[model samples]
Target: MTLDPEDSKLITLARAARARNGSAEGAAVRDETGRTYSATDVTLSSLTLSAVQVAVAMAVSSGARSLEAAALVSEGDPGSADEEVARELGAGALLVAGPDGTPRS
Candidate 1:
C-alpha cells in the first residue's frame, strides 16, 4: 500500500526511535492539532508499556484531545492495547510497519 508523506514520516520516526533505543518497538502519533509524539517501548522489570501506549500518553499529557494518526514499527504486530488507545483517542488510523520501516498490516 502507498502511504501518504505524513504517514511515511511517522514510520521513519518510529523506526529511528526503535533503532536508537534497541527496543522491541517504537511508535509515533500525530495529534489532531498537527503535533507529533514518539516513543520507544518501556520494558522495566516492574512495569512495561508498549511504544504506542507511551506515544499516546505523551500526546495526552501535552493536552491533545484527539489523535489524527499513529504509526508503530516493530518485529511483531502492534498489540491490542495500541489499537484500543488509538480508537479511544479517535485516531484516524493505525499504521503498522516493520523494523525496516516497510509498511506491514
Candidate 2:
C-alpha cells in the first residue's frame, strides 16, 4: 500500500536515520525582514534512502527540530497519528523546502 505523504511516523524514522549516517545539511527556514530562525541543533541530510528522508530534509530546512522530550514512531504501527506521534516525541512540526525553496508541510 502507498503511504500517506504526510505520515509523521515515517518522517521520524527517516529523520533518525539521517542523524545516524546521513551527512548533516543546513536548511533555510526563512528570509524576511532581515531576520530568520533555523534548526541548527539537529542534523539534516538526504542520502537517497527513501521518500521519508526527502520529507524530513525539507522539514529541517524549514526550521523544524526536536524538542526537549519528543515521541518517535514507526510506520509499522497501527492507527499511526501524525500529530499525536510528534506530540509524544516532544517535537514540533517541521517545514522542508522543495526544490524551488518553497516550504512543504
Candidate 3:
C-alpha cells in the first residue's frame, strides 16, 4: 500500500527512534493539529510500555485532543492497547511497519 508523504515521514521517525534506543519497538503519531510525537519502547525493571503507548501519552500530555495518523515500526505487531489509544484519539487506522521501515499492515 502507498502511504502519504507525512505518514512515510512518521515511519522514518519511528524507525530512527528504534535504532537509537535499540528497543523492541518504535512509534510515531501525527496529531490533528499537525504535530508529531515519537517514542521507543520503555522496558524497565518495574514498568513496561510499548512504543505506541508512549507516543500516545506524549501527544495527550502535550494537549493534543486528537490524532490524524499513527505508525508503529517494529518486529512485532501492535497490541490492543496501541489500537485502543489511537482509536480514542480519533485515528482511523494504525500503520504497522517492519523494522526495515516497510509498511506491513
What TM-score would every model get versus the actual structure?
0.96, 0.22, 0.97
Most lDDT-accurate candidate: 3
Cα RMSD (angstroms) for every candidate in the order listed: 0.8, 12.1, 0.7
- Per-residue error for 46 in candidate 2, Å, reads 11
lDDT rank order:
3, 1, 2
Cα error, candidate 1, residue 32 (Å): 1.0
- Worst ten in a row by lDDT for model 3: 84-93
Q: Which residue pairs in candidate 1 have backbone atoms (N, alpha carbon, C) closer than 3 angstroms, thus clashing?
A: none
Q: Which candidate is the best by TM-score?
A: 3
- In model 1, which runs have C-alpha deviations exceeding 4 angstroms? none
CA shift of 86, model 1, Å = 0.7
**Model 2: which ten-residue window has the lowest total lDDT?**
26-35
Candidate 2: deviation at residue 85, Å? 13
lDDT of 3 by residue, 1-105 (tens): 898999999999999999999998999999989999999999899989999999999999999999999999989888998999889889978999999999998
